[model samples]
Target: MLIPLIALAGVLPAPALARGMDEPRASLMVGALLAFAAVLAALALLVQARRLRRRDMQLHARNAHLAAANAELREVTERAEAKARMLDGVLAAMADGILVVDAGLRLAGWNPRFPDYAGVPRRALRIGMPLREVIRLQAEAGEFGMVDPEAETERRMAMFHNGTAPQRLQRERPDGSRLELRRTPLPGGGYVTLYTPILAPAAAAAGDAMQAAFRQEWTSRIPRLTAAAADGDVAEARAVAHALRGVAANAGWTRAAAAMEGIEETAAAGALTQLRLLTAGLPQDPAAWN
Candidate 1:
C-alpha cells in the first residue's frame, strides 16, 4: 500500500499536487514511513530468533544432565552385578552346608551342598519353604530317630519357636554318617546354620575323633592329588595339595601336616618336580594315614 501510494504521488499532475501537499514534501513523508515499517519488522524478527536460540540451549543442557545421570546408574549396576557374582563363587566353593532363614524361619538362601548335607531332597527345599516342612521331610526320612514322624516335627517346631532348640547339636544319619549342626543368629532377624559332616562316630578323645574323620578323606583324595600332578595341572595339583595339608593339620597328624606344608611351599615356588615327588608318596590307603 505504501509503495502504491508513493507511485500515485509521483504520477499525480502538477495541478493535483498543488491542490494537496507538494511533491517534494509528500515523497519525503512516504519514505520515512517505509523506513519505520522496515525497522519494526526487523526488530520483531530479531526478538523471535533470540527466543528460539535460548530454548535450544536449555534443551541441550537438560539432555546432557540426563545422560550423565544414566551413565552413573549404569556404573553402579555393573558394580553390584560383579559383587553378586563374587559372592556366588564363594558359596559354590564352600564344603559345609549353609542355610539362611528369615525371622519367620522361612528359607531365604542356601548353597549347593546344603541339600545333601541336611539330608533333605533337592526338590523338597525351595526359597521361602517353611522350617516345619524341612523338619517333616527329615522326620519322614527317619532322621530324627524312630519316633513318630509328625509328632517329632511338632516337637522340634515348638522348640524353635520357644528358643529352646540347641544352638549346636550332633546327629547321626541312618547311613551311619554323622553331621554336626551349629546355628548362629544373624545380625538382623534371621539364622544361619552350618552342617559339617563328621566322617566317623564321636570318640572320647578329640585326637581319636580327628584321626577317624581324616583317614577316610585322606584315602579318597590322595589318588586325585597324584593324578593332577601327573597331568601337569599345576593349579589343580596345588588346590588338592593345600586341602590335604588343612586336613592333616586338623586331624592332629603332626608329621603329615609338616610334610604337606613342605609340599605346598614347594608348589607355590613353582618347583613342579618336587611337587610330583611329594605327591608320588601319598598313601591311597586309610591304614597308612593311621
Candidate 2:
C-alpha cells in the first residue's frame, strides 16, 4: 500500500514536472501528507475491531453464568414442591381427623376427615378463620345445649387456654355415633387435635396400652412434683401439677388428679410440707389407679 501511494505521488510530480520543477516539489509534498492520513484511519479501525471482540467475549461469559444460576434455582423449587406433596400425602393418609391451630387460634391445617369426625358443617370450615367463629356456629346449632352462642364460645375458649384443663372430650352425634377428641398443645405455641370414633374393640386394646404408659408416667412425675413443691417453687410446681392433672384426668385417675391439684394449691400458698405430703399420698401401683 505504501509502494502504491509513493508511485501515485511520483505520477503527480510528473504532471507538475511538465509545467516546472518548482510545482512538482509542492505536489509531491501534498501526496505524501494524504497517504499519512489514510494510514492513521486504518489504525483506528483495527483498534475498534479489537474492542468489539473483547466486549463480545465478556457478554458470552455473563450469559453462561446466568444460565447456571437459573438451573440451580429451578432444582431448588422442584425439591421444595416434592417435600410439600409428601407432607400432604401423610396428612391425607391418616385414619383419624386432624385439626391444627396457630397460637392465635386461627385454623392452620386440617384433614378432609375433620368435617366427618367433628360433625361441623362444611360451609363453616375456613383455612385461616378464627376457630372460635366455627365454635360459635356450632353453639348456634345447639351443640352446647341451650346456652347463648357467644357465652359458650367464650367458655370453651377459656377451657382450651387453661394450662391445667383436660383436652379429652366425648361427643355423641345426632346419629348416635360417639367420638373422642384429644387436643395436644405444642411447645411452640400451637395445638393439634385428633378426632377418632369411639369404637369398642379398638378402644379396648388401645386403652390398656395407654393406661399402662400413663400410669408409669404419672408415677415418675410425682417425684418431680414433690421436689418442686418442697422447694416452694410455685411456677415449677404448678407446671408439673398442671401436666400431671391433665393426664390423670384423661386416664380417669381421680385420686391422682385431686392429689396433683392439692400440690398446685399448697405450693402457691407456700405450704411446702403439705405439698410434700400430697405428693407422698399418690399411689404408685398401676392397679390402684382404678
- Using TM-score as the measure, which candidate wins? 1
Q: Please list all clashing residue pairs in model 2, or write none if there are none.
A: none
lDDT of 1 at 70: 100
Candidate 1 runs further than 4 Å off: 1-20, 23-27, 200-290
* TM-scores, all models, native as reference: 0.60, 0.53
lDDT of 1 by residue, 126-212 (tens): 899999999899888888779898899999999989999899999998888889999999888779998888754344366466567
Best by lDDT: 1
Q: TM-score of the candidate numbered 1?
A: 0.60
Q: Per-candidate RMSD vs. true structure? A: 12.8, 16.8
lDDT for each residue of candidate 2 in 1-290, tens digit (9 for 90 to 100): 45546645555545545466565667677667676656756676777889999999999999999999999999899968865774465556555789999888899989888877766787779878898887897777766567898999998888767764467989876667787889998788778998888877887788779878887887788778767766777778888887887677666565656566566667767777776677665566635755
Candidate 2 versus the native: TM-score?
A: 0.53
Candidate 2 Cα RMSD (Å): 16.8
Model 2, residue 39: C-alpha shift (Å)? 4.1
